[model samples]
Target: MQTQLAVAAYIIHNNKVLLIHHQKLDLWLPVGGHIDQNETPDDALLREIREEVNLEVEILNKLDLPVEGKTKKNLALPFYTNVHSVGDHDHACFYYVCKVINPEKININQKEIKNFDWFTKEELNQKHISENVRNQALEAFKLFEKLTK
Candidate 1:
């Protein structure tokens, strides 16, 4: 089976997480998509967010690695990683938590998303949300809270 690399971000603002109802999948999920060729994970993540929600996000997770000799840039590390089946293929997904730079500037791509909303911690526990997404979103919320404090 073919497995493609993908990146996702849980964008948090004002103690709420941004979720998009994907048109094709018909499921509410974090903003993300397949990592394109020649694009780094960080680039793909930012691009996906822009295409999906038109919001710039600041990744909450950071690698403290020293940049001395060769490369001076350090990409944010993923908070979680998993492989999940999608139709006949699979997605090797890297999960990240982020903070929306401008919450009021959102403009969802209507073709890719059915709707978008912000969910609080209590709202994430609703039965309508998929179990996997709920758990991951909760974790992202916790991480974001800890980082900000």
Candidate 2:
């Protein structure tokens, strides 16, 4: 079996969290994709968000440090991480919470995304949302609130 590294983002804006109905996976999930070779995880996350939703975002779990010495860059720490089966293979995914920079600029990539919605706290309990994703969304809300406040 093969495992791949991936990045995902729960984009927040206007007191709501974003989820997309993935066309291929047919699941409501955060905007994300496999990290391309030669791309940093931080870059992969930002690129995924932009490609999936056409939105700009700032990763929230990032640490600000001088890019110097042996370390040239700092990447955002994933709030949660897990390995899960995606059909024949598995993905070790890095999950992040991001603050949307242009909330009004979201345009779905129709080729890969079927639909999109912003879920509030209460809305996260809806049956259509998977338990795992719903719980993560709830946690993302808390993290976002904690960071902003």
Candidate 3:
């Protein structure tokens, strides 16, 4: 199975996580896409968020380790990583928890996303949200709390 590198973000605002109903795949998922050639994961994630929802986000992660030499920059760490099936292909996805920077500016790309909604941790238990997505969303909340506090 071919696996392509991808990035995803669980955007948090007002104690809720945003999820999109993918038009093509017919699944509710976090906003993200494959990393472009020669582009860093951070760049890909930012670009994906911009293109998908037309909003800015702040990745909530504990970047910058004790060892600093030779490192030009410390990229935001993913809260989770996994290889998941995407029909004919698989995506090795890096997942991050992000805080919404511009809450009012959101325009979903209708071509890729059918609809979007912000779900609280309690609301994520609804049957329509997939198990995988629910778990990720919950974990994102934990990571956001741990990192931002």
**Which candidate leads in TM-score?**
2
Q: What TM-score does candidate 2 reach?
A: 0.97
Error of 1 at 26 (Å): 0.3
Candidate 1 lDDT by residue in tens digits, 12-117: 9998999999998899999999999999999999999999999998987888789988996899989899999878789999999999998899999999999999
lDDT by residue (tens digit), candidate 2, 30-144: 9999999999999999898889999999899778888998998888989999999889889999999999999999899999999999999899889889999998888888899
Candidate 1 global CA lDDT score? 0.94
Provide the lDDT at 41 for model 3: 95
Clashes of 2: 0
TM-score on alpha carbons, each prediction: 0.96, 0.97, 0.94
User: Number of backbone collisions per candidate, in order?
Assistant: 0, 0, 0
lDDT of 3 by residue, 1-149 (tens): 89899999999998999999999999899999999999999999999999999989988784567656887677898989999999999999999999999989999999999999999999999999999999999999998887778
Candidate topping lDDT? 1
Quantify all predictions' global Cα lDDT against the true fold.
0.94, 0.92, 0.93
Clashing pairs in 1: none
Sort every candidate by TM-score, greatest first. 2, 1, 3
